[model samples]
Target: MKTIGVVDTTFARFNMGSAVVDEIKQHVSARIKRVTVPGIKDLPVASKKLIEEEDCDLVIALGMPGSKDIDKVCAHEASTGLIQAQLMTNRHIIEVFVHENEAGSDKELAYLMEKRSREHALNAVKLLFKPEELVKQAGTGQRQGFEDVGSIGM
Candidate 1:
């Protein structure tokens, strides 16, 4: 059976990883192994362990970064580490992040996180089983949270 490893940080008030798992279950039947770390910095090690030890097919990492410059720097470091983990394991790691300042209000930020998390979960499922489903979104100016970036120039 296909397995997905979910890694999230507790620095944020929301349980975004749970939201991703719940959404994935709605459309796919895959085993989900979740591990919650203290902060974004801890996600990489936990993700590596989940794939190497737990035998997961893929990993989903979720975190909420604050507005400060230091927070962004830390988030960047954590994301780079996650990428390295993926390279080492030869598995996909969907890194989902929502900045606390992405939206103007708490409600908006929450909504963006929920929408992005659920969408990324669906993306993970598609990556595993129905890759064709993901093709439909290519180059489309449609996305959750902020406006879509669409296809950039070559």
Candidate 2:
């Protein structure tokens, strides 16, 4: 059985880790491990630990950046660290970040968080189990939280 790790931040307004786990469970049978940190910057180490210590095949790193310049900068820094962790572990860490300002209202924000989390969870499943599914959709514009802008005539 494959192990999927989920690292999320407590600073996020939504419980994206639960959303991810729920979505993954619907598609495949895998041991899902969850780790919660205080902020986005902590995602890399937690994810690395999940992969190196917990024996996870893949990790989903979820975070929400507030609507501020510093928050955006922190999000970028976290993303860079996540990339480094992936390189160090030679494993995939699916980065799912939803900026707080992406939506205009609370309802929209919640929807984006849920949709993005679930969609990325499915992507993780496909990556581990059926990567060819993704190859078939290549070049077709696919969006997670919003409507997919279909492929252009190439």
Candidate 3:
């Protein structure tokens, strides 16, 4: 069994990604490690290296999508948030996510979060069966899917 980390980020300048990681763990296997609510970010490079080197299994990153404007909803925003956040899911397996509180509590914000969550969830599913199929499963989001999940404005 692979040990996986489920992390959530909050207190960002925007609220699009918060309070949602809890909801998406439903599908992962019971053995997957669930990191508490503390966001994963700003770890020392050495620390980050250790986590990656720990040989856990996967370093799944989650995120929420919130924007008044339009974007393709890739894994980039989540990746940036991950680097800037104070938390990181350093494990293997799954990084399931769902949207909770975002930008303005507007319906659009909610919709985007949910959409991103679904993507995360779906990606998790694919990871389970494929594992090495990331490039095929994940879109061209710079560094997310490796980002932590947070608020959804719910």
- TM-score of every prediction relative to native: 0.93, 0.98, 0.43
lDDT of 3: 0.41
lDDT tens per residue, model 2, 30-84: 9999999999999999999999999999999999999999999999999999999
Which stretches of model 1 miss by more than 4 angstroms?
Answer: 147-154
Worst 10 residues of 2 by lDDT: 145-154
> Model 2, residue 16: displacement in angstroms?
0.4
lDDT of 3 at 8: 41
Candidate 3, residues 1-154, lDDT tens digits: the string is: 6444444445222232232334335555523433333332322222234346543344345433334232224334444544543256433333333333333455655565555545554455456545666764344443222344543433
Model 1 alpha-carbon miss at residue 132, Å: 1.4
Error of 1 at 81 (Å): 0.3
The global C-alpha lDDT for each of the candidates, from Candidate 1 onward, is 0.91, 0.97, 0.41
lDDT of 1 by residue, 75-147 (tens): 9999999999999999999999999998899899899999889988988998999999778777776675567
State the lDDT at 71 in candidate 2.
97
Best by lDDT: 2
lDDT of 2 at 13: 95
Candidate 2 backbone collisions, by pair: none
